[model samples]
Target: MRLLVSFLLAGLITDGEAQNWHGPHPWRANAVVDGRARDYNNEYFLHAFSYRHLIDRPSPIEEGIRGTAGSLTSDRLYMDFRYQQSFAFDDPDQAFTLDIQRAEDFDGSYDRQLVGFRQTLAQRWQLSLQGDVFSDKSLTDIYFGARRLHSEGSWLQLSLVLPNAYFNDKTDSQSELIDEPRTLFAQWHQQHTPWASTTLSVNHTPDATLDDRTQGDRVSSRQTRVALRYREQKGNWQLQTDLNGEHTRRQHQLDERPAPQAFRRDMASLTLAVRYWPHRWQPQVGARYFWLDEDGWFGREPNGNGEVSRQEPMLFGGMSLSLSDTQRLAPTVYLSRPRVEQTVNSPRWRDRDDHGFVGKLSVPWHITVSKQNGAVLSIVPSMRLHRFAFGGGNVQLHWPL
Candidate 1:
């Protein structure tokens, strides 16, 4: 992820806009004139960065053009397979389970399969094994866990996650997989009452350096994350909130670079959502705040160290209006103001600064078909205009199984 940031920074310093000698980095002008000019790819990088950092995307975009959900109405077909079952023994105290799920996206973005098995050793105790198989075998993962039910409505889980668990997979070096560290995961969930519940989870990955043979680089990283979630239902309203924080330190050694580069990043986020479920209108509201700070050497050059900071707060509001006994229209709007700043040499030189208030509006029409097992099919088509000029339009389809 930081690699993209480094490339973007390089583009900013080499683009045509930086040719003038008005800025402090007058030396960059010579570099730009000496054949290190940025080409048309600069716009692509800027849009990609903006889409990830600033835009409130409504759905996943495939190949920078089409939305995943919107593609359902097109000629292409996509499908997912899922199967799960539990087997009981004569002892009545022992049982076995099998699970399999595969997602096949037409765009080849989420092509993966999960196979898992669980066995009950004793009452209220179970053990499980799960594996994730990705299109790239080097990215596979495996988990071995045990779950204990402490009470009627509470449980605890502990697991060991083996990152890049695949070995001798013809695709990558076996030594790189063997050197990856095993991550630790723990979670606790409790139900206080019929209407309220809470959950806490923690994950930690110790420092380790592994050869990314596929990319011809070396990465050393350590990360820890803690999160909590709360959900409750009171009267005619339902509420859910989440809080999480993470710290990460990473260093990268490119094959072409002689020196190693490193960075540290800290992030925190809060979210709250409320819905008046029992009301006719079914109004909903939610808000989220996220902040991040990163400082480190992002480029191959030693002098390419920098700091990046971002803060984003967003609000969401929506309601459902019944059009008929079998039809409804739900429209939701999102408003956000995101601020970002990037500087090199501490606070001495500013590289990029941007802040803006943007919004997105979505209106979806829901249709119920009783013959199709009362399935709810939603067709969402949206268009926008600014200053009497057409901006753009999009369409999406949703059908639940």
Candidate 2:
């Protein structure tokens, strides 16, 4: 019965995200808390710069651009980890896990080594850390926080972030400039009950560095900046808002180097999302509205109000099906806001506002194997189709023990 129990209890985890499919067990996921530690190694490069000291993200131009949720997204392979072992799994009070990863890109441009760790502290506190070392440089990330076993779901965490030293040196005067950025952040969240909850986060970067991810450029080289977020959830609905307030001189670097164009900007955003999932056959309906306010460039850009105020409401709906106790299929439809777009690179004329429509079908599968006690394999395959847009899809695979 121990082997059968282990096989049934071992839940599948992918990209560090886990869901408990079965009840509690002696050697199970509940032994450790939080999903970050479960998948820290894979998100090293594509991670956020918070108090946790996560890995420095790739250059803006190198990062993956996300579209509709659950649509075909980037297949960028994060560090591949081979799990080694766990300590004191039966006792939920004291549990720990370790993983080793190879640091490199999908094309195998660079090579490095990474190690991840997660440990429970004094029963309620959770600690997670990740480190990486290349041939010439090394980076470290550490996080300390605690959540409750109560229904309130109250929690607090603080993280310190340090960027890569290789990118810190600003030497290239002609092109390709760089700087090392550091940040400190704190977050507090409280769930009064299943019906209501609130989360707030504040992060400060001593040296302002506005990373222009779309163009992969450092628009703002140096300045003091602060970013924060506030979110409140009630029932199946939630409202999230965030702000980026910084006093800095941003520039548009063109071929002519004598004097680059510069501007000062500020921005804020509010988004409301609501979801309904009462029945399996009834299409789950979701909707989101975004209000963007900006000044610096002139319209509706993040750094400017270029005189254009852009507000686009989106429509999201999907049907979820339960194929089995451990398997499910979900298909969704989306309607994006209509907007007029101009050619940026070539600088052309003739424009029209166009709305977007997309559809997605995703299947998630789980398998159990009693290898060395228990192991779970997870696979997710998805397909998407778009009207007057590029169609795409992706597949994800993971085996967790």
Candidate 3:
């Protein structure tokens, strides 16, 4: 369709800056700053950055205005919002939909928005186009998706995501830059019976490279992931299970370096949850297992070679009790022992083994807004403890628009 082609072309004008290093572990710049070394740690900063980059970091007030919490060198919290509306065109089946969303991470590092449009075709197929726009108004990525409806509660969907990039000027300071990577996503869902259903999904990102200006840091990576989910409900009881696995490979190089360093990572996790509902009270229990392995160079040669692995199994339980017709209180507790092993050949850093018991508690208040549309708002306050000592705590609010 001509409209679809125009949407795809719109993706090309997205702002694209050179991607940065994405090694498994944090990477320190070759140069030091103010008696300390500069480092790049995505997990902490929400993006890759070193000491020099801190100057450009947003202040707490700025973060708050954006509805994000947490900061570098501090704990993280997130606030997410979503709203959607649809309008019918000349034909009843031809509709234009607008979806707006904001999502951030616990640490306030990742923030994204979604702008979408959807159209119905043949009464069974739907075509959707969505753009991932950042707070700065720069387009990061776009998704084209098609869904085929087989019947109620059953469908098949496919999507392709293209990362946008552009060249400043071949001779200018900003040369070729690709801000993000391209990806392919697929999903299938089926409802065998009124009480049972299953879903499977796959996500793959082929090899992609980020080349900075004339000369700077460059990185390349490839990844694949698979996930399965199943749910069943009967007689006021609900059960759900989820399985996921992912593998990633990365190569990094400094400007004009002899060769790039290689890094590999593998992650797998499984979770099972069950809920029993009774009049005004509902109780739930869940178990989860998570594992990760990483081996690669984190920074410049001779200093970043290392291997790290972690495994954790956890159990959690919770219950919800209705306090009023539209209000309920839910409390949950979690317990886990995580073990991590790191082996590195470096002087400033030493190989070590760390394991500890971690516990967390959460109390959330839920209020129903629109019973017909199943809209609700939740306010959650949580606390954490490690080795019986107070670790940290956070409060989060979830509201649907």
What's the TM-score of every candidate structure? 0.64, 0.49, 0.70
lDDT of 1 by residue, 1-401 (tens): 44322222221111111011010010110111111111111111111111111110110100111112332223432222233445566765555554443332101223324466676666788787776666776567677879897763567888887755654464445335334566788878776765665677777877766665555456676777777767666776777676777677767776767987677778877767787876788787888776777777542222346777878777767787999998888776656667877676633345767676555555667666543433344555432211232212223222222
Output the better candidate (1/3) by lDDT.
3
Give Cα distance to truth, residue 106, candidate 3, Å.
12
Model 3 collision count: 3
- Residue 122's lDDT in candidate 2: 64
Off by over 4 Å in 3: 1-75, 78-87, 99-108, 133-140, 165-174, 177-181, 298-305, 343-352, 385-401
lDDT of 2 by residue, 1-401 (tens): 53232222111101111111010001101101110111111112112100010011110101111111122125433332222334555666545543333222111212223344556776566665544434434233222323333333456666555534343243222223233355455656555444343455555544434333334334443333333333333343333333333333345542323444454433332233333434454344544443333223221122221321334455545554677655555555545543423212211212223344434333434333334532333344444444343333323233333
Model 2, position 185: C-alpha lDDT score: 55
lDDT leader: 3
CA lDDT for candidate 3: 0.51
Q: What is the C-alpha lDDT of each candidate?
A: 0.50, 0.33, 0.51
Q: What TM-score should be assigned to candidate 2?
A: 0.49
Model 3: per-residue lDDT, tens digit, 1-401? 54223222221111110011110111111210011122212122211111001010111101111112222335433333333455678887666655543442111222234466778888899898876655433234567889898964578888887654222222244534444566787778776666666677777877776664343557676777777766666666677676777777767776656787787878887777777755455677888776777777654433556876778777777787789989877777767777878787755456767677666665656666665533455555555544453323323222222
Worst lDDT run of 10 residues, candidate 1, spans 17-26
- Looking at model 3, the pairs that clash are 46-109, 76-106, 77-106
